[model samples]
Target: MRKILVVGAGQSGLQLALGLQSHGYEVTLMSNRTADEIRSGRVMSTQCMFHTALQHERDLQLNFWESQAPKIEGLGVSVAAPGSWAEGPAARAIDWVGKLDGYAQSVDQRVKMAGWMETFAQRGGQLVIHGAAVSDLDYFSRTYDLVLVSAGKGELVSMFGRDASRSPYGEPQRALAVSYVHGLGPRPEHPDYDAVRCNLVPGVGELFIMPTLTTSGRADILFWEGIPGGPLDVFNGVKDPAEHLSLTLELMERFTPWEYARATKVELTDGGGTLVGRYAPTVRNPVGRLPGGGLVLGVADVVVANDPITGQGSNSASKCAASYLASILERGEKEFDEEWMRGTFDRYWDAAQHVTKWTNAMLAPPPEHILNLIGAAGQLQPAADRFANAFNDPADFENFFYEPGKTAAYLASLS
Candidate 1:
């Protein structure tokens, strides 16, 4: 059997490891934290996986929480009117909900990753619990037929140098904060069905309210993407969970008062339910060279770390794993050479570039045409549904998102 070492038990690493194990490969999965530790730790992400990404998990029979998690039927957008914020209850300039063809769902990574780690072990895959450094990867490279770095945090990331041509930003785009809570009242506009609520505060930033299944059971995630140094960027030093929830609600009241009204009675699900941080959206070279001259291929965020403004982090990771699995299976008895590594990443990039482009575009102020597209969606049901479903397939954005002419043409057709 071909021996493979996957460093990082995240969405990509763990999924790829399990897939390889199913194919009779000798797979060793490394994680910095054990299942127990991960279950008891802080929340990792606001992962709202759409249909295509969710289907990948189902194909692997790894969608354990599918029946338990809430079905997100659509995505709604509410843009705060000019001079509406802080004046009182925020008034919406434009508001509409776009139904997704297939529902999306959010299962807290704390719940998903922990369950997956235990599942990986039960399925006979080797699970190693230790923080992996470059030296560690160098040593593993000697024993395994292939080494892949899926850990996108700490020193492991520095192994892969940034690809300057593909990476457009040098500094963080948004200051991010998140709080998972209970008692978040349902949206009155759509009380019968669940949806991801995206409330735009224009220059200040955005507030995303997503129904989620967490360790504590059914809950909601309140996420903020604040422009750096802006008024919404206030979660930097918050340590107390109560204080974090306090700050999160305070901002909601100030900027997205409509959401604030529903969140007034909510409380954190657990002490680990809050998170805050930021990073530049970047694309890095696929292969990393170790000091010992061994090579490791970077996966997911290690290669393409787009800002969460578009909520594509988890979706991107899932697609990367599925794409890599196919590439590895196709290699047959051939060596896992540098050429093969680049080819694997190139194959994945063919799909990821759409995500990267759309995500990077979202980080900046929406251009006039883009703004017009969003506004017109409010009056056109088909436009709204098409826009909502794009969250599941970002490649569709290439049709009308990047150009004014296309935007005008698409809306005209809808009219």
Candidate 2:
């Protein structure tokens, strides 16, 4: 059996390790936290999985929360009126819902990652609980036939040099804050709240509200993607979950009053339910070199670290794992050298590049064409549905979303 070392037991690393183990490869997964620690630790991300990504997990028999998690049946987009931003219902502008072709779901990473880690161990995969750094990669590279890094952040990630040609942004795209809370009442006007509600305050930032399954139970997640130095970028110095929750509510009241009204009764689910940070959308070279001169391959966020603005980080990670798994399986005793690594990464990049493009487009100020598309989506059910479903396959977005001519033609057809 070919031995493989997967550093970082995150979505991609764990998934690939388990997949290789099932295929009779000797797989050792190194994690910084054990399953118990992961379960009891702070929240990791606002991971809402659409159909394609969820299906990838199901195919790997990893969808443990499918039965218990709330089904996200649609997506809602609201654009708040400029200058009308205040603490009341009058601050709203236009709101509309778009039905999805299939449901999406958000399972808190604490629940999902811990469950996955335990399952990996139960299935006889070798698991190590230790932090890994670039200094250790030289030894790891010699020990395993192939080494794959998938951790999203930290010193290990810095080992993979930024590919400036592919990476457009030089600094953090948004100041991100997320709070998971319970006790949120259903929207009074639209009580059937089984959708990912995205409120865009053009020029300010965006807010995403979703039903998420947490360690405690079903709850709501409010994620703020604040443009740096903007009004929504107010999470600095807030460490306590209650304070985080209160600040989120205050921000909502100031920008999205409709959502604020619904969040009036909400409280942080736990001390670990809130997080604040920032990351530039970056694409790094897939192969990293150690000081001792060994090369290790990077997968998922190690190579493509998009801001969670478009909710594509985890989804892209899953796709990368699936693609890399296929490539590795097909290698069939061939050397896992630089050429093989580059080829594998290129295959994954074909799919990932679209996600990066679409996500970056969303981070920028909406062009007139995109505004027109959103308007059409509000009025036309088919347009709305198509737009929502595109989230499932971001690659398809290139056909319409980023191209002004295609978007105009699409809108013309919608009429």
Candidate 3:
């Protein structure tokens, strides 16, 4: 029997661990903290998981299958002028988000992580608390057939191999302040307002509002986005995040629903709804080889890419876990040697590179004509929907990555 050890209990690690167990591998998953330690109701960032992502999750039989995950109503996207962010061409996306087979909406990340860990253990998976820290990590034995690392935190980055991209994305961490509110008005007037309201402000960054089902019977709004000089940084000295948050929302009110009027009280997690800062640091393609890789493999955020802006982190992580598990099952421990594991690492990187490239390119500043094109497309219905779903298509992904042909296609297909 091959003994596999999975480090880091984040979503990626959890998915990989559960996947390996299902394939009849002797897997032991050890996370650094307990479930309650990480649980919090703060932000909503991801759209529904992609169809390919959902299928892999089901094939692996991840724990949250029966849990209350979202059935995405649709995507909420906006395109506005560079300076005037408050008002712009708004687009509502339902056909894509709402119709995704298994997952169109979202489940809380904290909940899913906790749920997966529990289920993995219930079905005879091993888990431990307080495993190896990245810097202090050193493999004791090659006894364990394979060791997979999927730590999302920064500490995990140093414990991996090199990146191999021409001009990989930069390391820019932004501060985001989020809060859940009740007693808000009806959804906005945007076309897909019934599904999701995406506020796209070029200079100000992004703000996404989604209705998520927590344990609470009533639907709650998760207000979230990353700001350059966000409240957490500018008001770092304030010492009261609740107050800072209230002010932040007030300043950015023009883009959101008219809900600020009814926010009676705010429930702050981590003592004030202050998240331990988030980053979208980019590096070259995952290293084909690490210094001392007897058989330690990279998974999810740790390997392929990092950045929640594209909302591909979680989906990519889930898919990577499946692919990683499949590889291990096909080839036993012997295949995990430094050379072989390097190949697996390369395979993982190759799979994620195209999507990462596409997202990174789109995130960069656009030219004059392209901006106008996006503005025009945002004004229409079908064009906007196709623009959003194109992310799920590889041809579109490549088009977006290499050229503006896809955007041109959107122009030609306008309603």
Each prediction's TM-score versus the true structure: 0.99, 0.97, 0.81
- Candidate 1, poorest ten consecutive residues by summed lDDT: 82-91
Instruction: Report the candidate with higher lDDT, 2 versus 3.
Output: 2
Query: Candidate 2 vs candidate 3: which has greater TM-score?
Result: 2
Best by TM-score: 1
Candidate 2, residue 54: Cα displacement in angstroms equals 0.8
What's the distance in Å from true for residue 393, model 1? 0.7
Best by lDDT: 1
Looking at candidate 3, the ten consecutive residues that score lowest on lDDT are 92-101
- Candidate 3's residue-wise lDDT over 212-281, tens digit each? 5443422444444555674324534545756765654654454332333334344433342343245655
lDDT of 2 at 202: 78
Instruction: By lDDT, rank the candidates, best first.
Output: 1, 2, 3
lDDT of 1 by residue, 1-415 (tens): 9999999999999899988998999999999999999999999999999999999999999999999999999999999986776557678899999999999999999889999999989999899999998889888899999999999999999989999999999999999999999999999989999999999988889999999999989999999999999988999998999998999898888888889989989999999999999999999999999898889999999999999988899999999999999999999999999999999999999999999999899988889999899999999999899999999999999998899999899999988
List model 2 lDDT by residue over 1-415, tens digit each.
Answer: 8999999887889889888988999989999999999988889998888998888889988888899999999888989887676444436566788888889999898898898889989988889998988888788888889999988778888788999998889999899999999998876646765989899997889999999999999999999999999988989888778888888888888888888888888888888899999988899999998888888999999999899988887888888899999999999999999999999999999999888888888888889888888877878888888889988898878778877999999888878
Global Cα lDDT for candidate 1:
0.94
| Per-prediction tally of clashes | 0, 0, 4
| RMSD for each of the candidates | 0.8, 1.4, 4.4
